[model samples]
Target: MGEPKIRRLDGRFDDPEIETAFMRDSWAGIRVQAALTLIGFSLAWIVSTATDLMYMQDSPYFLPTLSARLLAGSVGLLGGAWVLMARPGSDSRDLPLIVYGWILMSTLTAVIVASVFPTAEATPDGVADVLVFTSSWMSLHVLAIGVALAAFPWGIAFMSIAYMITYLILAVVWNEQSEHPMIAQSVVVVACCFFAWLMAITFSMRARRRFYITRLYEQAKIAAEKAQEFSSFLLAATGHDIRQPIYALDLNASMLEELVDAEQWDKVKPLVQRQKLVASNVASMLSSVLELSYLDNAKRPVTPTTCDAGRLLRDSVSGLKDVALSRGMALHCEPCSARIQVDSGVAGHILSNLISNAITHSKGSRLLVGARRAGQFIDLVVADNGAGMGDRDLFLESRSALARINGGQPLRSGMGMEIMFRLAERGDLALRITSRPGHGVMACLRCPRV
Candidate 1:
């Protein structure tokens, strides 16, 4: 979170995987540099040989220059071959190897140049010509190598410093060249190398920052997909495992209704009815869970058709009548004949959750469920007249209650509200809730009138 934990000296990421990812991103550039190294140095060696044969055949420095060029060219070929063949992997160390190879080749090239400078005074034009040639070579070498070392800021710095040190040593050894003093030359070369180091740092940092953001985005996408997959799996397993028992209980309840004797029926009928009511409530709760899961995944499809809003309201209320009765509350449905254009199944589920939530959490003795025509839309309403709730209580979800529950507080019973809200949203229906503490609570679902 704070500057991303990079190493102070080498700029390597503290996390090895992160470092490896950066290296992988740099691999293509490294390979290209290797290829250029092989081709560029081969041409340089041939040119130098030809130039010596044409102009400097009798010069004392000709053999030494030819030998140095040959040795440096051979080293460059070998190092370039190794770099070209190397592939980045899980190891964060692979990138450093490429950088070190470049450094070694650059150092060898510097040694070849440095060896010629000490004896520049012996040339026909004295040290001036040698000074001009060395300056041009150093400038061109630094600029070319810097471009080839793209995406590796630290490597560029190291190579530049190595070359500078080689030049400085040569300058010290050739102090006899008084006309164009070696000390002044060393200072200019050092400044150029240092400036290149700074530029390389800026370029590499920007590249690493981009790679970091991309990696984070990919990781987040994968995590989200896996979470959705896990949610779907859990929903499927829960529906199967829980529905089997509920289904068996339903079958047993039907069998009991048929097989019981008339004498025992009077007493047993109530128990069977209670069992059915409990089973129905469980099934309804399960349906709510499934609906919520579907909505979370954005996979629930809504098909709007002409539906009797009145019948839906009555059916939802009727299913939860026992729950209301058990809680010593009276459930009522107002008369209505409104029709609406909405997905019947989705609307039914929303109505059921609304009615069930009121039955369980309204804490009121009187509950009302009804629907009425309101211009272009039919509005289904569930209102409770018991001890009302606050706006916060109306919207508080079950998950948010976990912290309170852990602190020895009662968990809020608003999971149903959350589910109903999502279901209504998916069906393109409007849901609204109004609650006032100690007054009452009312919820409305608005649908297109048919």
Candidate 2:
């Protein structure tokens, strides 16, 4: 055998549907942020204004700068409300960037409000205390927003960096004459920002892991449902497979009784053969189902022992030779002497499945079973000279995907393909198929040689 070819990358990354899914996940976060920001802006402004009026009543700058403060709060309100109005399901990729814009606009409003009025010296106690209370309330707002932004880790990071920088700038440039402990404020603000970022990351990981697990559950549910459907299809399609054999057995039973009554010993030979053939058919169908259940349930498997690969193939082929001849086909095993480690019964089952599939579906006149040493492994090859599939996709999907029962190039026993796949996987064997439409198929099973 030659080396396998390297596969090229041809994945669908820029798919439009993928972008839509991304938007759906993000839309919830953006909507929540918008609603909260709008509410926060309204409450922050109303409280600050009412206090400024009561505390700074004597300050000359208070009355004149009141209008400028109102304008800043109004800007934040309008930005939040506007973002909230945009339909959440929209396919626009810039919605996240737009949310960032809202952040910038609010930050700008805060800066403008700061520059509008100077801290008055006359009512230092009243003015300073009111401002201090407002700043404390604002710190709590930052903490609340950090918790809300947990769904979007990147957004939390951006907000944390921006707010930390804003705090440092205000502490140095605006609090020069303030009697408050600016150093303590700076330290607390910086520490809180770091904590917020870590908290959001923890929340994001938990949320994403939960979503991934949910997806796996859905896929498993779908597989179980598909298996049920396949079972139903098996009953419908193989109705003849069961009926024909049973009908033959009934006829043979009647003939066997008459031959015995007449005491014709030689005449009963053909009737006995007919009874055995029909019984074998019934047994084969039931046995396939039983084998499938055994593999699926993860039953304990037998241990492998060193055996002659040549004899295994020869014995399996011999058993199927009569069936092949009945269908006007030929089966043979290539001479091999290489010893390999395998559970002989399981290996025989695998060989029987591959050979039976070839006889039934291969449309081939001849099939050759062979084995050879490849490096440290042994390759069990089943090659058929028959028209393969319309495409390799069907070949690759033989396990989960259904073959057309009546759509038919002899898709006999679903057990043949499905069982082979599961058994190969359980036994830790490497299975590969090589074929095209016009050409035949070669199922290569590779396992370690002892």
Best by lDDT: 1
Clashes of each: 1, 0
- For model 2, how does the per-residue alpha-carbon lDDT over 1-450 read when each residue is reduced to its tens digit? 222221112111144554345346656765766556655755576557875586456776566445545654675566556667754455554445555554555444444444333354435454345345434543555566567655545555666676667666656655645556466666776777776777766655555445446656776898687567655544543452344345556666777899999999898997687567557646765564444444323363455789899988875565456556656788888999899987665666567667777877788798989987799999999988888744543354344443443364445433356556555665567677666775788887786798
Per-residue C-alpha lDDT of model 1 across residues 403-424, encoded as one tens digit per residue = 4542565435552454555567
| Pairs that collide, model 1 | 364-386
Model 2 misplacement above 4 A: 1-86, 114-134, 174-176, 213-243, 258-271, 294-450
**Scored by Cα lDDT, where does model 1 land?**
0.65
Task: State TM-scores per candidate.
Answer: 0.52, 0.50
Tell me the deviation in Å of residue 126 in model 2: 7.0
The number of the candidate with the highest TM-score is: 1
